[model samples]
Each structure stands twice: as structure tokens, then as C-alpha cells.
Target: MKMYLISDNVDTKTGMRLAGVEGVVVHEMEEIRNALDEALKDRDIGIILITEKLGKLIADKIKDIKLNYHTPLIVEIPDRHGTGRTPDSITKYVREAIGLKI
Candidate 1:
């Protein structure tokens, strides 16, 4: 099993490349979708890392794939610009789920 990446920026792609993960950079929704489809077709790919920005462009499609398929686990990763999530989002989620503050 191998990990593949679909990034929105050259920096992210380059960074991942140094880690030995091969990937492509795409900016448009169509290109992102096409890249995702191509990644899905590869049986050797067990994980697909997509930048958060690109993932947002096709959130529904990714959700559907996650629900219907078992292979090629899709993950949303932050880019060089950093994460789009609020600083306390994970804390908030934990509190909401367990009713505890950390």
C-alpha cells in the first residue's frame, strides 16, 4: 500500500515529495475531481492525502466516496498557509462529544 497526494500548491507537493509520497497539484474543481478519480483507480494507493482547500471544493464527492468505498482512505491535510480550522475547533469537538473541557 502506498500514499498519494493531491495538493493545491507546489510547496505542499514538494514537501510531501521529500517524504517520498508522489502527488500532483491541481487548482480547479474539475482537476481535483479528475485527480481523485485517477487515484481511486489505483489499487496500490491505500491512502490519498488532499490539501484542505481542494477537499473543500469537492466535500460532497469525498463524503460519498468515504461512505461507499473501503479502499484509498481520503485525508484532508493543511497546506503551507496553515490549517483553515479555528484554533480551538478540536477542543470544541472534544467538549461537545464528551462534555468535558481540556
Candidate 2:
């Protein structure tokens, strides 16, 4: 299985690069979408870590992709210069998983 790093900033890519993740791909919304589609076409990608900012911008598209594909596990992480987590994001997923508010 392979991992992918998707971000829109240079710092994020640099950090991932330093961490030995040479497959880091930096792109804007449309380009990111196209790149992700092409990457997902391959069967080796098991995890895709996306920056939260970009994820928010393309939430609908991500949701659609998730529903359609099962090989690549999509996870949202904070960008190098953004909040790592949000209360709303946490609560929403928690509520959906447990059927209760935390």
C-alpha cells in the first residue's frame, strides 16, 4: 500500500518531503481533483492525507469519491498554517458514528 500527501502549500509539501514522502503532490482545487482521480485509478494507493482547507473546499467531491471508491482511505489533516482540528468537524463525525452528541 502507498500513501499520498495532497496539499496546496509549499510548507506542507516540504515537511512531507523531509519525512520521506516523495509522492507529495501540491495542486489547487481543479488540479487536485484531476490528480486525485488519476491516482485513484491505480490500485496501490491505500491512504490519502489531505489538508483540511483543501478538503473543505472540495468536501462534496470528496464525499462522492469516497462513496464510489473503497481502496483509498481519505483522511483530513490541518495544513502547516491552519487549525489542526475544528469542533464542528469532530462533533459531526462523532455524532454520525455514535448516533449521539458528545
TM-score, one value per model: 0.89, 0.80
Write the residue-wise lDDT of candidate 2 on 1-102 in tens digits: 877778887788788888766455556677888767776886877888788887887899789878987779988778868775766987998899899988
- Misplaced by over 4 Å in model 2 are 24-27
Off by over 4 Å in 1: 94-102
**Full-model lDDT for every candidate:** 0.95, 0.78
Cand. 2 Cα-lDDT: 0.78
**Pick by lDDT: which candidate is best?**
1
Give lDDT for model 1.
0.95
Q: Compare the candidates by TM-score and give the number of the best one.
A: 1
TM-score of 2: 0.80
